[model samples]
Target: MKSTEPVCQYELKAARDAMEVIQGKWRIPIVISLTYGTKRFGEIHRDIPDISPKMLSQELKALEENKLITRTLHDSMPVTVEYALTPLGMSLRELLDELRNWGKHFRGEIVGK
Candidate 1:
């Protein structure tokens, strides 16, 4: 038996780039949390307590660079910053939802949960 499929180099590179953007340990969770609403750096840290500040900062920077998230600075008595999904990032919610459903389906089979 053999597989019959057409492979395009551009498609392959796009897939790899997409994976690279979301490949960090904390990226997915961070994205999921922010999907609900905008969050301050501290709020994101609290939501994902296992992630260190350094790691979270790094992940947020990477996501920003990938155009998946937007960082906004607010001017006030004291400066504040918030993170939110960009239009491009919001577009990924549907895909994430499907992935979540797939995980739910596989969890019991794989972990007896």
Candidate 2:
């Protein structure tokens, strides 16, 4: 079978940086949740039921620090905060879609499901 692209030439530092941001039990799921639209902290937590509030806070900070997501505050009777993906983060849609397809293909091959 022919390969799609040349073997990856990713730099160790660059790869590690990428991993550092998404390195968690919930980051990818969080990203997927945000894919639907910008969301408030509680909304994101509700979407990913398994993540603890503390862990979710930590992960959100990491994502913001890495420029993958933006956090905003709204002033009202009750303050509100929302998070949205940056352009760099939105670029992951293609990669994530590819991963879903590959995972489905691999699972079928391995588990006969």
Best model per TM-score: 1
True-structure Cα RMSD, model 2: 3.9
- Cα deviation of 106, candidate 2, in Å: 2.1
lDDT of 1: 0.91
lDDT (10s digit) by residue, model 1, range 1-113: 89878899899999897787779678889999999899999999989999989999999998999899999999976899999999999988887898799999899789994
Best by lDDT: 1
Instruction: List runs of model 1 lying over 4 Å from the truth.
Output: 1-11
All candidates' lDDT scores? 0.91, 0.88
